[model samples]
Target: MRYSRILEIVGDIVKVHVPATENKQTAICFGDLALIESIADSARPPHLSQVILLEGEEVSLQVFSGTKGLSTHSVVRFLGRSMEVTFSPNILGRAFSGTGRAIDGGPQLNDEPSIEIDGPTVNPARRVLASHMIRTDVPMIDVFNCLVESQKIPIFSVAGEPYNQLLAQIGTHADADIVVFGGMGLIFDDYYFFRKAFEDAGVLARTVMFVHQGSDPVVEGLLVPDMALAVAERFAVEEGKRVLVLLTDMTAYADALKEVGISMEHVPSNRGYIGDLYSQLARRYEKACDYRGAGSVTILSVTTMPGDDVTHPVPDNTGYITEGQFYLHDGVIDPFGSLSRLKQHVIGKVTREDHSQIMNTMVRFYAAAQDAQQKQAMSFELSEYDHRLLKFGELFQRDFMDINVTMPLEDALDRCWQVLAECFSRDELLMKDSLVEKYFPTPADTLSQVDP
Candidate 1:
């Protein structure tokens, strides 16, 4: 039986108060998908599109574009389910729009199981320990602060910094078997760069992309990540593949959600965002899971601080939901403010023997050097130790901490030892005696240093 169209609205929401019969009552709820077809002025043109969403009996359909030409009595059909993403090996290397529909003009992926987007998260009790490591070839990340598999982390950067380049580089270099790239509110340049670079790197075969450009309906941005993750979860759990999910500018994603929440006239919370801000973010981040019986999803998300204010609601709420954050500043990862809470999980277990010890010693002295720099700037009388610390901090920043300092983990740690020896004696550095003897260069040993 066809349903009758009852009312219409302008903002992508169509009201369909269906007439009911004894045993043929309508069974539709909010968030179920609905197909809408509209014919305006019958002679001019007709608008047709797939199910967008169902709110009560009123099916709110995104009319591809908006309902600019839609009129009353336009036909609507309920799909009886929500929008779903196609999950299969074929989905990799393909690009889709926010609605899980292909944008690259490729053949439709109809073979994979169609699972609902934004499905229930993994059970907390069933989630396995995040023990494996995801090696990103970037030295500042892999060596200094390791990214653990199944870890949910965000890079906090300003708008002008190279966070996009960093994300693309990681996608090109990550050791994961599969990568799901989700871009929310990307401009044309950024969207094109990812496609070109991934193709050139030959990693495009194992990757999937879902993009929502700036001009697309803002609602698409909110759904892009969920669409990507829906496919990723299926790939990981079924194929036992290590998957890395990369998301750029999640702030735009959140803002898109907040915009919809505002359109619905929901009550405001902190910073004028909807009250469910934290829950919305957690729903996406919680998708980063390592299935005990199969594979995993490790999330590396980008959350840009508006006006460089970390206290902005978008990032402030993200900091709470994610495992930890990579605080990017001035085109480099700021060691002083940046931290990886799960760095300890993999430092000694998955990495080299001296990784944990070297990481501990380097950050500790780097802190001391910061204080020495402050003293010098204030014109305080500098002591011998202060002078040495000043030199150590400068060298640390120029060598290990900068993003351009790309090297393997072992080389980065050996460089750390060289930086330490130039400023302080082996005993004063206060490391494990055995580790020092094994890894640290002796007085007679020749070690390379950053030429001052």
Candidate 2:
């Protein structure tokens, strides 16, 4: 194979100067992979890199590993292909690096057909309208927000929050056929937490994880989402599986993009991020889709806000692309700020008949409780109702809103009613009479339960 000479090396980026005559015969395109051969030491294995930019005869590449001990005269062999990941059922229960290499001391993946990552999203015409709900068994989400299938939602959170823990819980409890996790810039502890959580929950057999640690190659960080989504798409499209793709700390992913953009000398947009930040995020989120007759792919990602700023570029841009977001504040999913845009389509239709009414009542009482707490703090005399609100609020946080609480939707709905009955009278709830009559506890009902 013919080779081109490297003209310059900066950090992980290598600039190869190709002749106009050679370019005509062997065209170099963006996203194409290449091998950098060491002329100085021919014994060393060829380093892998990808073409990130192309202008006339000057092509720039981002080396996967750092370009250390590399020379300008190194031979550049264009692979004429983009990066790909092996896609098959064998990928389940396996852990891979961001670049799709096995990193969990597992056996090497056998010869499986690989598919290119970062491809275009499935066409809208082929997508079935998302009308089904994927139950995560979390009251804050399943009851209030109602995670619809094929919907793309985010957990907008700040650092130090249990966002990763919440994600692991969801992966353990979500009812999808398979769970695909993509972690960017995660610490070793965070990575271990996910693996242990999945293993303990016995879901590891149906889960796949692609992790990019804080110390891994920066370029590999950019590939995690693509590798995850590519495999997820294959499972949904080919294997007919309901796949849930969970990504934690997309802010780190955006930071990696900014770093690469800066090295490439591209003009920065908001907060030093590349100009196409929204498009870049949308490309991945749009991969969530429901096939016509097969299963669907639902994306629930985490976009951590730096300094708890909602206007930060990562979450700011994410808000526009996702159907809705769960605001994880103070370790609880804030109901007032969280919403699911497509929830209405499934709330009453797919969920239980009383799901909507119960959800509304729970959130309403919680809001009232917050107001009562504020009134108490301001030294205002509390009404009898205010005291009840306070009690209800405490119970809500303890039993329903806590991220650790795991129960079926029906059980959670019953818990909501019990909290209401213990704190307030029947009339105070103002719920649908049919539901109140059906689920509300009465004096006799309470007595019968205690005696037995």
Alpha-carbon deviation at 171 in model 1, angstroms: 1.8
For residue 270, model 1's alpha carbon misses the true position, in angstroms, by 2.8
Report lDDT per candidate. 0.80, 0.89
lDDT value for model 2: 0.89
Worst 10-residue lDDT window for candidate 1 reads 44-53
Q: Model 2: per-residue lDDT, tens digit, 78-122?
A: 888999998887889999998788888988775877999968888
Model 2 bad stretches (over 4 Å): 447-452
lDDT of 1: 0.80
